[model samples]
Target: MAEASNGFFSAYVDSWDVLQIPRIGGFSGTVELPGSKSIANRALLLAALGTNPDRSCILKRLPDSDDVNVLRNILPALGVSVVAEEQGVRIQADHHRLSASSGEFYVENAGTAMRPLLAVLSALKGSYLIYGNEQMNRRPIGDLAKSLQSLGVEIEASEGGCPPVRVSSDGWKSQEATIQGRTSSQFVSAMLMAAPLSEKEFVLRLEDDPVSKPYIDLTITMMKDFGVQVLRKDYQEFIIPGNQRYLAPEQYEIEGDASAATYFLAAGALPGQGPVRVNGLGRSSIQGDQGFFRILESMGAMVKMGDKYLECSGGSELKALDLDMNAMPDAAMTLATLNLFADGKSSIRNVANLRVKESERIHGLKTELERTGASVEEGSDYLIIQPPSRMKSARFQTYLDHRMAMAFSLVSAGVSIEIEDPGCVRKTYPDYFLDFLKVAQK
Candidate 1:
């Protein structure tokens, strides 16, 4: 079957490098994670659409990861000038909109980029068509489409509720738009970031319980940092007064990803004499995913978290427990890795919300890990993990999911594995291969 399109863009990608991961001691060095993919992509859209009285908008702590880098590289082609520096990225959009005619641009699997960018481009009142690869097409954006429909934006879909979604912007006439927050926080975030430009304020109510409330909260916090005032959170109800234009901040820095820290943290606890230390992250901040460290403790991992650093060192046999991952689904992948070393069965529940994301995380992770000699059981909203009597080496299929590739890399502790599409790690961690090597051999 032909790869799915977002309705317009297309690309042929294959034959990435062959990759290998080895069992290493726990990590002990301070690892600097790339900027938050979540925040970096969101900030980029705001900056691209933002107007400044004097100069272009400057965004900081921009990660050198592939996803952000791709967006930066394609911005100029799409008619926005992006200035790249070690310190940050700057853009001078000058209010020129994202039109459909902008040369062909492929967003890869950066769902954070695809969803919000679609909404922002839709509000620009111009014809702009966005397309991506197989994985990007697989990620569901139908909820986002419905909300855009309510705002008078036009979307054309390909299949599987997939993209090739040709979106055209119309001057937004915001009315009360309710979102189902139980699925993915990105939908809520898309509306929150784009609502500021609409003619009428938006009254967004969460149709059911909000699963990833922290991420939606982070979106608002970042929006405010970039000069958009989103009203306080009232249960599931959120009010954003539209026409509140965004001003590019003199400098905005994206924090290192707390979700990325989970792997190293898990390695520290998984029966290794080596030490693992995560660096360049605030010990405390608004990111709710940071709370995953608490979950690690509950799983019997030895952890020491500080103001700006966290260290995990393996001390005893690890046992798993039922974990609620709704607020931090990104960390769920790491939890899957740690579960393999567990002495007893463990389950991570409430992550049914992850099915329609950049990948079907639960099934993909479970299916792939099973190839590495693990007894895996999948439930609608949870995973029951039973470790194999002994670990064995096997090929690990990454399915183009960066987290899937990284999380499964830990299998090297028990097996010598080959990972296909290992290059996918570039999505968020461009130097992941190098970093994994340094930490493993050290």
Candidate 2:
């Protein structure tokens, strides 16, 4: 397939089997990032839940991606009105309109959609068979299902706790439940979003610390924006009073994706004429991945934080450091690849959850990094990488993960590389390579 050009850089089209990313001298440009996938989906669900005949929620800057589209497309089946506008999407829903409906929903590898939809559907009068693509079925949802089962919702998953979850319930029959947080914070967030639908106060306890606690925090923050309050005790327990419903804001604007900004930030931190600026995310951002710029600063990158933007420039020399990345598992992949430009070996710990993401990320990262002549030590939950004396040009397999396709693009800073399945980025940022080409200089 020929690259698409519109007066600027060429972009890899979906029909292309492989994308050749040439060596770039440096990065220098501003990228206006798309709406965050986490916030977009959460806000979409909340908007739909809060929707009424009189009040239709207008969400601004909602990302147009496969993940967000999954929820957008499925909301109408529950009798919710979702209209796509030039600016964003408008959701109109009434709980009274929701009836006892039964159908199969294909979420297509979107965890944000599958996990939350499971809880929300169970809260409504419905028999839902929520399944996803092959990879999504391989991912676990049993922990979330078990928690809902505790609330008197009949829920079941495939053997080994995978997806294709079947949920049948009239509504919440119990008020108290406990969820194991070790696997995913989405389970807790899902429960919290549905708790307000209960007749009595809902109390939820955590069995363990969640892998991505910031995501839960983001969920609560967005929930509050929708006029729901959740009381929590040090992230261990949560209390959401019943007899409340989300009040859709007249207009809610979603911030840019911080996770996607990691790529540009890492590129700016490379040795080049950099100083790349990513607009729409800044110090006041709610996303945990916004902290990724600080990781670059720790690696000797000059960083500037504004109220609504983050800027980065390469420092004197990049330094390696060991850190626990449980909070920012998504950005850890960029950090792992960034090691190629660092001065020493680096260790990323406490991100075992990567094993169950869109792909087996931990093992996949180890494989691809080693293919590029880097020495990688793979553990059950950690990866230690020693940068090679010299980087090599190699073809990187994306494993059908969006992050994999984007994170490995950093290799273009040092060597010409080929990325397989560049189309995988459609899961989140479809125009990733187009934006990447903006900052890259030959």
Candidate 3:
């Protein structure tokens, strides 16, 4: 009942009221999505790191979102010039010096920025401080910090393994950086990005099985796209040769956001809703979240996949499924809500990491699902849900998490539901509900 902290979104959520989601008989249209945030942010940082002496790197179809905005703003402060162009942004790095003026850099709840930058700034030559909003400061970064420290980087954490990280390094020294994968894969991705800039060849040894291999693969693939080769032996080890530099291409086009596409895909897969086609991410999408459609297919949805588009239809009688969704946590949240339409109980497993996300996702989903007249049971690493005999209208609280607001919107497919803090979608898809309405007409 009490507000979390005085962040920008927190203030905005205080004055917001419940948003009633539109209930439609079916959906039949194509939704054009913005670029992938995961890819966009990674490319932006890579462009900054790989920029030639005075030359520039260009990227097209960048996602215009809060997280991207935060990274765009932070780059310039670190001495990278970001020029807005016709279709994309041009990044100009200081060729003479890798370390620009470094001071306190604030990233508001962007795990992508905070994690990667921690490893990156540690590889630079200046004393830098990185901090984020109240929520981000509470998220774990110790695993990443310790790995960097083992590589001879001077860094400090505030209290726990959380952020407000301070980095003082001459440069990255060549050493075997061992990191655990049980946490977020962002840790591995962060070090991989910074490993190339180290003084000697770098070998990243994995301690445990990684959670999201696709994201790590995405990072490696993009690194290679920029002309750097990473020798990977399964997910256990990654070898990056030292003195390597990132080469910028003429331009790179970002793929559509697969995580964002799951909502519409789910809509189309629902019993009454169907034939929703989403453009952007396709069969060749490098993003792992694209696999979410396979889950839908397993649940009996008819899906069509193309080179650059995906369409879903049918599933008049949806069936429940038990799935391990650790690979696609964000998309899995949409599945959690979509389970409401299933005829029997459903189970989502291997998502204990969800507890440390924007909010306690597992607990939040159970609470909100029960509030909306569903029978739910929560566990340390999983959720079990039994669809209600009939649906009931309820106001679902989002707990200031964007995925919660977006995932819960699926409840409207079966019953009318009101979402609290609807503005929270601005964290990623600002026009989400508006876009949903466009394709949701029968």
- For all candidates, the clash counts are 18, 0, 0
**Candidate 3 at 17: error in angstroms?**
3.0
Off by over 4 Å in 2: 3-16, 94-100
- lDDT: which candidate is best? 2
Candidate 1 positional error at 395, Å: 1.8
Better of 1 and 2 by lDDT: 2
Q: Give the per-residue lDDT of model 1 (tens digit) for 1-442.
A: 1222322111224546446544543455557776777778877877776644355777877888878876777666656778876666778763444433434557887778777777777666667677888878877778778877876777776776678788665566667777776777888888888777675677877777877888888888888877778886664888887677777776777777777777777777676534677776667656787787777666666777777777777766776788878888888888887788888888888999778766788898888878867888898988888888888787777767888878887777676667777767778986665566555642
| lDDT of model 2 at position 132 | 91
Which 10-residue span in candidate 2 carries the lowest summed lDDT?
1-10
Candidate 3 per-residue lDDT over residues 353-413, each given as its tens digit: 8998888899999999897678998999999999998888788898879899989887777
What TM-score would you give candidate 2 relative to the actual structure?
Answer: 0.97
Error of 2 at 35 (Å): 0.3
On TM-score, the candidate that comes out on top is 2
Prediction 3 global C-alpha lDDT: 0.85
Candidate 2 residue-wise lDDT, 85-139, digit = tens: 8767788885644543798899999999999889988987778898899999999
Between 1 and 3, whose lDDT is larger?
3
Question: Which pairs clash inside model 3?
Answer: none
